[model samples]
Target: MKIGVLALQGAVAEHIRMLGLAGAEGVVIKRTEQLEELDGLIIPGGESTTIGKLMRTYGFIEAIREFSARRKPVFGTCAGMILVAKELSGQEEAHLGLMDIRVARNAFGRQRESFETDLAVKGMENTVRAVFIRAPLIESVGGNVDVLSVYQDQIVAARQEHLLAASFHPELTDDYGFHSYFLDMVRQYR
Candidate 1:
């Protein structure tokens, strides 16, 4: 399986490494044209506003929407989760607006307040280590969305069909379980 990590910004190499450990060929994707040959794409953690701007400027906004429209798997981590949500708490618009979720930007507070924890993800038997850095919170999810994992009674991970979202940076940990879970999604839809 060929999984591409959005290389506009943020832990691009880390995500690629995770994907490799998950048994998939990882590709660094900068151009929107790279979406074609990928079985799935991971939008890594970064500043949400900047990622939104870059996606628009690079023509990925529509390209990605189209890609998801075809049932292609998309995984969004941290700020990437904000980009994929349908609604932003105080904002009037969304970046990708692909997932049926409402998100709170920087809900975990500032960078200084960043923390790590083990979460009971829905499918996995073992707890997954999650690192939260100025992460977004999935305040609510529509009927189509499934709450995958929660931390302190708050939603931190979710999935809506082929779209997987995480409020924490899964790439920051040594565990490849989350990435493998995403690869399973890709395999199902591939």
Candidate 2:
């Protein structure tokens, strides 16, 4: 099982470390061709606009859109979640728009507001300590998206077929369950 972590920016090392811990082959993806051989990909949290622009500057935006279109699993976190959101309100930026949802950027305020909380994620019984850093809260989910977890009436995590998005930084937490779940999805789909 080979997984590529979007090395454009943000949390790349953590995801690569977690993938190694999971006994899966991990690679940092920079070039467009690096995406070709992966079983799955992880789009980590960062400045959405910068990442999005870098993806295009590096000619990866359309490639990613195409990659996910084939029904392969891709898990996006935080800024990654913003990139995957179908529509973004109040933020002028470009994104992959792979997931069926709308997002509100900096929903939790700035970096100083960064905090952690235990969330009751679906399919995982234990309270997952989710790390939120300049995270975007999901405004609404489309009919096709499954609401996987919620916080304060807002959708925090969701899955739409092969695409998964989370408002928190699961990569920052010790819990690798979400990563494992995404890998399982990759295994099942592949």
Tens-place lDDT per residue, model 1, 1-190, is 9998998889999999998888999999999999999999999999989989999999999999999999999999999999999999999998999999999999999999999988899999889999999999999999989999988899999999999999999999999999999999999998
Point out the worst 10-residue segment of candidate 2 by lDDT: 90-99
Cα lDDT, all candidates:
0.95, 0.89
lDDT of 1: 0.95
Residue 164, candidate 1: C-alpha displacement in angstroms: 0.3
Q: lDDT by residue for model 2 over 2-88, one digit each (tens)? A: 999999889999999888877788899989898889989999999988898898899888998989988878999999999888899
List residue ranges in candidate 1 displaced over 4 A. Answer: none
Clashing residue pairs in all predictions, respectively, total 0, 0
lDDT of 2 at 79: 93
